[model samples]
Target: MKRIIITCCLLLGVTLISFAQKRVLVEAESFKDIGGWVIDQQSFDVLYSSYLMAHGMGKPVEDARTTVDFSEGGKYHVWVRTKDWAPFPTGPGEFQLSINEKPLEDSFGVSGSADWDWYYGGQVDMKKGENTLVAEDLTGFNGRFDAIYFSTEEGDVPTNDNEALLAFRKEMLNLTENAKDVGQFDLVVVGGGMAGTCAAISGARMGLKVALIQNRPVLGGNNSSEIRVHLMGRVDQNHNAKLGRIVRELDNGDPGNGNPDADRYGDERKLQIVRAEPNISLHLNTHVYEVEMDGNTIKAVIGRDIATNQEYRFEGVYFSDCTGDGTLGYLAGAEYRMGRESRAETGESLAPEEPDDFTLGTSNLWASLEREEPSDFPETPWAIQFSEEYHIDDHKADWQWETGFGNFNTIYEAEEIRDHNLRAIFGNWSYLKNEMPEKYSHHELAWVAYIGGKRESRRLMGDHVLTQMDIQDGVMYPDGSVTATWTIDLHFPDAENSKYFEGEEFFAGTKHIKVQPYTIPYRCLYSRNIDNLYMAGRDISTTHVAFGSTRVMRTCGMMGEAVGYAAYVARKNNASPREVYTLHLNEFMDIIESPLSIHNLPTLPQD
Candidate 1:
């Protein structure tokens, strides 16, 4: 007990402690049983860690409990890491910390600093052998906490500095300084979106060993049940017809945006298809944050398990940045661009007059179902207040219900974006139910996305950045691969929404600039600087104007398929991503032109 407690903590051996004073740092995410609390890693990039969230959707959730054993136990100071998400005078996210079923002195997660920090919970007496710690949610309005720390000394507290906090967490949790080695693969495809999934499948089908890593539990990114966004863009357009074979196979019929039915998204079908591929190693709920660079090439990528906080190192011959935010490329020091491009920069008609941070926003969609009986919704003053005239009077929130525009850094301020969307959803619903009762008497909120469907972020620069002129003017590159057919759809705050909440608008409006089908150049698929990196999806090399057309899921999926086939050429020739185009373009294009076994789509009976 002394050896384990006095020194570094052993997870199985139980208590973590300091030498001078007995201390234990219990990560809330590492709790033994998180009954109703959902593990949230949405803000891990900014916050440095995942936390337990009471996402009971306005109902009190079940308790999250863990057992702790220590050599010496007495009066110990308790510190909880949390924030007041709704920082109004009265907060809705209120929770209690109970030890061995006895409630702690303080009601945590309410009346605290808006930023992530430690909140003091007055000292508690403990037994010498084993004790239980529980977090009981009171309000169910998204109460959250990072970790709970117990110390014999009163003043010794964990640092609020996120960077320093990372080091401290590693020490306390006994996390390895070096990432634990995951098995080697021919290609490591980070981000299990439509693009990355297709990449893995296409690569595996071509007899290449692959690893597909996704941050969420499901394979589909935005199209998954968690986010409920439909797959857009026309697959099997002009150019190589073989490119979209895998994407068409994966489409299980779009349920439309914000569909409440989980089965409609075909989560298990995507999982089964990926699992059926013997050559793929599917890693879900694993977020790749650290990049191991071997000079110009990426040697391996380091990821952490959101639930268990276990670190793993995945080594690969080639890597793909399918992460919509371009997280992988950014980590490898790949040159990337964000925000709208000015007219002078891209020479595009639709380009913004001046370069600013007004990039396409993220959407956190919500939906409601009508019930037979009338339901009661509590007043949410913390949420955005809406009136009859200003309120969006839809039964379900569609793609237009969006945010994260105008100076909002979609990557850094992701959590705020989602929260803002939530406030908008709850507030509008509240107004309708209370103010206009007759219209929405039977309507009840069914689902609201916790995971935001992001449209634009870091655009990893490649050999050539696809511009609006290339698509509209039909400038054909010799290395043209995947065909783009979706309209150049650019989004902005709805004029009516802006009139109500000017700088912080939630509703979105878009204008579609039509363009003829054009093949996207292969040059825009891989990183320009990083030797082994290939990219697909929203993060692919494209100016803001060009990305407006290329950001759709079906198109991105075809891009992934193209990258996969190219990887086969790279592996056979022992070439880099750049060389695949410069040297092996002929061979790659020949393969792309070949016919593929198409899946049978049941057609309607001819009348």
Candidate 2:
């Protein structure tokens, strides 16, 4: 009997493998006519794949259409991989699946399943040739799904278990197990925000072959058209005057955050500058989730194309973790810290008494425009309920329209943070339009940012963790380069906003601690343990209070410029990031002091 059972199991495995072609998987992001759906890849590091989100403010968007050609299709079971973003009872993101213009009876994204899981849409008899699939959005409030599955056999469905799901997706989509090599580079910068963009351009100008990778299609992170954050801090005050040149060139001179004019942020200017550099290879819409470590150093980093599901391997001598969450450093086993530090430990006056999980929150800003006539907005019962006394009486959502403070982590719970902001935005708008129509009757909703502008998450540890004392006293290290000019602006929950909503406050308040411009050391730009790794932007080594000043975009850009010059010095002497400071400080400083020239970089440092 045992022998017979083993034979049956072996035959079953072979049968399953042989009939794998009977099922087909269609990724939602790959749909030819996306229409009104937006590709959201922010949480791809955790979710493992990019999904489509309906980002309509309060109205249902146009249907997303795609065609599938099956080999003589008969009856196929339809399964949709989706999630209920907000489930007070029922979710707001209710959508449907339609085959050949006929809608399915089952509704998806409203199943009250918070996590990403599969939903059965019943069996349908498909035609032998091409069948058009339409994703119909019932609500305009962030309805999202990863993929759709069609199978010929019964009782055979995809698994929701992350590990098993990956294998299933690979088999169904024929995704490659081995990553294709993308050639060797002197530096691989894994972000294309202000910091990473400057790092790539500076390195290329200094004669280093560079690879700049960005998860989004655009170049800027917070300042992109998607997020609409204006450039801050004085780029001119840097100790190295040349360090700010690249930042100035990219600044679009937008006066405020969440501006309705997307062109005011200069997305094209950033992309054009990066493309002009012959030595830099910019890979947009690529998310890096894995890294190969050779002892303490990174051997190679593997990235996946968000829409296409193609994988590539990048090998480099040195790497930078500008991925604000310290994603690359965390994967490479580098030391990092999240949340606030204790006053006793760091000896900073601004720190909390005890080390707690209270970190700065994220912002999903929105804007509105004044119209001649009143515009209708749907009353959202699924959204967070707002009262006249509790709601913010404002025309536009700003940086203060933030969430995910206290226990909420900006990295792990990023999706929740963004969703919470969405609820607040819609609820406030509804109350203003429905309850008090006289004030905002002429105003219509403009652009609402789906990408959350994160303030703090994981701060990578370095040899020197710049504290409040360092910025306050102006402690000057020998390798001090970028001059941070922004005020020490630490953000927390607003007093009134928190009074109504305790743990999840959408509004923010900050107490600015004014300080003189301070020079930041190069030691804070590289990892302490990871020999070949460098860092910039918000992930750079800084205590919670000190980061308030250095976390601004212009300051982060200067840090990137310093890192680029340091990389050039390191390459000449065959040294790590630390050696560039300890062994070749003078040469690096000389390069920093010189004016930045796009075509004419100063001669090589003496051998």
Q: Please list the Cα RMSD from the true structure of every candidate, rounded to 1 decimal place.
A: 5.8, 5.3
TM-score of each: 0.95, 0.94
Kindly provide the TM-score of model 2 when superposed on the true structure, using C-alpha atoms: 0.94
Which residue pairs show collisions in model 2? Answer: none
lDDT of 2 by residue, 362-395 (tens): 9999999999888878887878889967777887
Give per-candidate clash totals.
0, 0
Candidate number with greatest TM-score: 1
lDDT by residue (tens digit), candidate 1, 566-595? 888888788999999999999889878873
| C-alpha lDDT of all candidate models, in order | 0.86, 0.84
Q: Quote the positional error of residue 457 for candidate 1 in Å.
A: 0.6
